[model samples]
Target: MSFSIIFFFVFFVSILFCFSNSDEVYVINTNGTKIIGRKFFTVFEDKPYAAFWKIPYAAPPVGKLRYKPPNPLRWLDKPVYNYSIPYNESCASGRTEDCLYLSIYTPIIKHIFDFPVVVWIHEDAHKHSPDFLIDEEVIVVTISLRTSIFGFLNTGDEFAGGNMGAKDILTALRWIRDNIGHFSGDINKVTVFGSESTAPIVASLLVSAAGEDLFQRVIIQGGSALSPADYRNYNFEIMNKLYWNLDGPFEKFNRTKLYELLSKSSTKKLLVASYDLFDSTEVRDNQRLINSFPLTVELSGKGAFMNKFPLEVYKRKITNNAVEVMIGYTNLDSLHKLDGFVRNRKLLKYLNYNFQYLLPFEGRRDEYGSKLYKKIRRKIMDFYFVNGTVGERSLRRFAKYMSDQVIYPILRQATLHSQVSCNNVYLYRFTYQGSFSLVWNTVLRNLNFSGATSGDEICYQFKCKSLSTAYNAEETSNERLFIKKMARLLGNFAKHGNPTPHSSDDILDGLQWLPLNPAKSVRLLNMGRELKMIKLPEAKRMEFWTQLRNEFFPDRRINDEL
Candidate 1:
């Protein structure tokens, strides 16, 4: 045979061997439900790993169950679940009532039986596999919960108490606690990790009474339940618009009638009405620093996820006091939000005229035209603008002004956790700008931005095929080095409850990353061109906000009491 023919024969034999070597894996939960899964190779190293995808842990929240807490699944017939294939995409990309499924990936190497588990909760949790992290000899899980109005609509009573999204997450956690061990995962070493928009969920789980003892560690980045944007009352005007769009008598309907109409509406109609309420220029005008679909204080009951606000939960020590926490934020978390101002000069003018919008929602709750409201708004304008107006010239300052709203809440939560929790609180600032800067390149088109944006760190933490096109070439030395560092940092935390714990590794370069000492000062490791421990970045601005909150919005209460 010729040389080409010989090569083809060898390749064909290798393919056959690869297929023959693969095996199907199955696990039986404590409840006696057999779940069938498949084994796959990692993206980079091609090492074998097991994946169980799209396994339902809760009953579908459809029909009468809409807007209610998730119900634990019942295997009435003792069925065998053959979830050998993955879903088409992340559930966040679609609108559905039956989206409460979770996927698990575990290292299947010989002699590795019980690995640390990292439960990932993100809006785009399923867009990419955790192949890279799996290569680090850890088990990874990605979970999906309801989103948009379907997950948060409330009439403020037992029928529709809201926070169904949060309750879904809580149910998923219970499932992991009971079922993860059969898949070679250590339930005690579970670390609940969330990034960007999902950070609030992780933080909320940290403080909720229902979340106690479910997980031992947490990693939250770029969000906090304390952020005004994440936790607030539903916009009543938007609720009214939704009712009107649904063709229901707006305010005249009783709570029971409202619940009946919402639970019975079609998913398409609900989505259209939700979009109608959201797709408008005055969204910011009406909502004013509030998240469009915000997490609410659920009514107290057997299944209440968050009966009290997170601050009160922390104050009263109704939280997991021994759970170690790794929390931080990017330098320019809100940079992409500025893309609108860059395109619309009209918005800049509106911003200047409506300076009160710059204030936190807590400040906005103060009556308009009140003395404190004016003082707070004027103080923010003067501090950020420095005698200038909101325009192209002040874009950088405005980015800081916008990003601070996100960062302050994270810092506040870190401080509170450090003070009250018996375990250590490790905080860091992710400032590394890699080639795949999601916000810098995709959203802003690489407009001379230098810092990392909110979700930029995710590309380094995982091998995402969707983001591969962002790279102009193969991974640069810096990108590889950064990825290794991130894996080591997080993997160390999951296994040993410390990132640098002695730091004999070459990647960390003997960096001893210390935890927060809020009693003295808040120090953080700045992950950047040079990794060094530094005093909090933007100290002056942080102090300004701390003083402002102390003076104007001193206390946070649920129903005006803890």
Candidate 2:
């Protein structure tokens, strides 16, 4: 046989046998409608669980639907056919825009209606495989939705609204409520969780009237609605400028004209245009054109970002009781990101030139630089660095300043707010080092420094093939034990609303994970040779930064003032 024919025949046979040999099937009903699903092996043993993949939860947001709120999944009379969950196709090519899909992985069913659901929401990134926690007896879901310009672009008026991203998440949760039960899952007892960028999205859902009724628990790791400033007042001036720069004729120079041209462009075209304009735009001290772009403010419309500022949402909720919350950050989450900024040999000079980049802008840079900014900077510098230091000392201080100033304040604020409003909050710091060192030293060759950076601990939750290779036959390391142990704790939390199950036969060995105390403490996970709770070391420094941030931004104000 020819080589081409041989290859094609082999590929076809492999695909056919893979699906037919090891597949578990079931039918689920939603509102008298029936849909089919297939089960796959999870981290658990021989007992396999079910999965319904690539299920559409919303109407496609294309053309005029762009920048508008997502409509719920319009069902058809005929039952829909689905295959094993495929790789998330949303933004799959870094361009496709119709990715409003969610997949459910339910544990082996003993009873049809007996399991808590955990919904995963993140921007752009999606986990496409059979999920973890199948053994923990909870259903895990991954939601793939719109993000970037496709989700956030907006006009100040009602013609084009913003925050389509947050709205998409809300739509997904509603779909889950209407349909999750059919898949051997619980709808009312859902825990919504997100890591890094998506944590803000989960945080926004906490205040949402529609979302609040849907989910009961939330887990925010490394981001929050209050700390990262999730939503901002839409700047009409900036909006107009964005359209003007979208490779359209700007000589006519009118918002309406530019907006029409933008609306006509494809999602890919607009995304490309954004990239070009984003780099050229001179960002303010506090924001990046794209990175710090917050969910759009919708003052009088549907799901407005608390009428103006993100802080407004939190300020209003301080008195209102909310759902259970688990919030935390890694020990040195922001350090690696800061490494790129400290390339210049003269560290102090680098700071003088880029201190604005390192810190969130509380006021205009000119106002900040000309006044008390220096005194505050001096205090920070003295704490993190000696008056004169260079090379190794300088590098370590740079990392510390970035971690202590940029990351910790936000973490402390989120944990404290959750405790006050929700009454139950758990804080943690991921200090596991051994799991990540191999990836850094060999795979990435990042030899400069190593510790728990942002998103480092996520490998434990997702079945990462590369990380798994770190443990082959005959290797029992602390990292492996911690991963399994922590997974049990987190999975137990999803199953029982508490990581340490109260049942006498506690699966997690009765690990007593205490909640955040008056001191705003955190339960340290994999800290050096020990895993225990510690009073968050940065609380004092965080308190100082929080006061400083409030003085400049002001909880009542929408924008910063000198």
lDDT (tens digit, per residue) of candidate 1 on 1-562: 9975686567444434545543554343445555556777775567778888887889988887787789988532444465666675544665567888999888887766689999988878776778768867889998888877867766566666778888788899899998788788898899999888778888887788788888989999889888776776534665667677776544553545555567788887777777745543454443246566778776555677777777778778777778899999999888887788756545665667766544433543655567866676788888888584776577778889889888888888888888888999999998888675656667867466678778888877876668754433565656776777788889888888998886578878898999988667778989887788999877788788777766776664422110
Which numbered prediction scores highest in lDDT against the true structure?
1
* Tens-digit lDDT track of model 2 for 96-116: 677778877887666557688
* Predicted model with the maximum TM-score: 1
Model 2 poorest 10 in a row by lDDT: 280-289
How does each model score on TM-score?
Answer: 0.88, 0.84
RMSD to the native, candidate 2? 6.0
Worst 10 residues of 1 by lDDT: 553-562
